[model samples]
Target: MKHPMPALLILLGLAIAPVAAQQVYSWTDANGTKHFSDMPPPPNTASAQRLNVRSGVTTTQAVEEPAAEGEPAAGSGPAMAAAAGYSDADIKRNCAAAQKNLERYEAAKPAEDEEAEVQTRYQEGLSKVQSQIKLFCG
Candidate 1:
């Protein structure tokens, strides 16, 4: 009985091993001081961590204004900024092309009636247009 119990505990430990390894946090206060912690450190901390998993990591500075209105957000990567930035005229032109692609996709109407495929293609083209608009509008 003791042998089986120890084996079962070992298996349970192995199952939970991966999730126990990670931790993160981020916080900023009115005084412009920032704090990051895996867990509450002490009373002197900047603040307690936010509970959400997505924002758990305190990777970057928590600035007041986010990425300047219409500006490419920070950490979006140079490639994205380069790819997304377009002139006003370029955005309009790309948007026009995206619309044309959607129309063509709709008209193509496969024999199998695969609306999903057409929609996916149409959406991809539209996203390109949206990216251009986001950068250029800034």
Candidate 2:
């Protein structure tokens, strides 16, 4: 018979397609920080933002609010404002590393019995990297 492997592979791919595709959400924390994740935010979900992966665009469900303290008033969301004491090259390198860490945290798999702990760690790590990026990379 002709190779059945190709047909089987196609079937497997079809079966896993739905599970592989997921929606990512974004929301601000109590600290006025922005975060992204595959899971929706718990509170204020009505105002949570959705990101379009294919187009790399984000859609906001809530009206724009005032800028946070130390943040630029006119137009500064998540981009870092300054590098502080770090040099330009250092800031760029740190920003890239932080971005990569955030991605890894987002994609990490939780243990079956330690889901909550895993999620907490992920959020904590996300907060750190996001703050780093915001402070030094803009």
Candidate 3:
């Protein structure tokens, strides 16, 4: 009979291959920029997400930080939107929509007769869309 040892070893290697894949860590910095690296974030980093590249799984751990003066606490604002039950795909879709709205508002030109009113409406819409972008994209 043919030896089974080599076949068993192959199966074991296949099982271990996924575990050997490198992990990717993602976090948004205070400047509202997203970063990804193989290394974990510094201690006390808030809203850090660990991604298993092989399994396509992501887990988030928010380490709360003290709020700066006049600012909301870390992970209390848009950063918590994911933890609020929205999936990453949802956030990405919303962020894209918000960005598109902002672009539309920026490209719009008002007739002279309605310039002031249009400007006011555009400003309001822009502000709202910007906030959404921040919440979803970050």
For each candidate, give its TM-score against the true structure.
0.37, 0.36, 0.41
Tens-place lDDT digits, model 3, residues 22-66: 678888888988888989997788979887775455546466777
Top model number, TM-score: 3
Best candidate according to lDDT: 3
- Residues 85-138, candidate 1, lDDT per residue (tens digit)? 755566556556656655675576455656788767766766765555444333
Poorly placed runs, candidate 3 (over 4 Å)? 1-78, 109-114
What stretches of model 2 exceed 4 Å from their correct place? 1-83, 109-113
Q: lDDT of each model, Cα atoms only?
A: 0.58, 0.68, 0.77
Candidate ranking under TM-score, highest first, comes to 3, 1, 2
For model 1, name the residue pairs that clash. Answer: none
- Weakest 10 consecutive residues of candidate 2 by summed lDDT: 75-84
In model 1, which regions exceed 4 Å deviation?
A: 2-5, 8-19, 25-83, 113-138
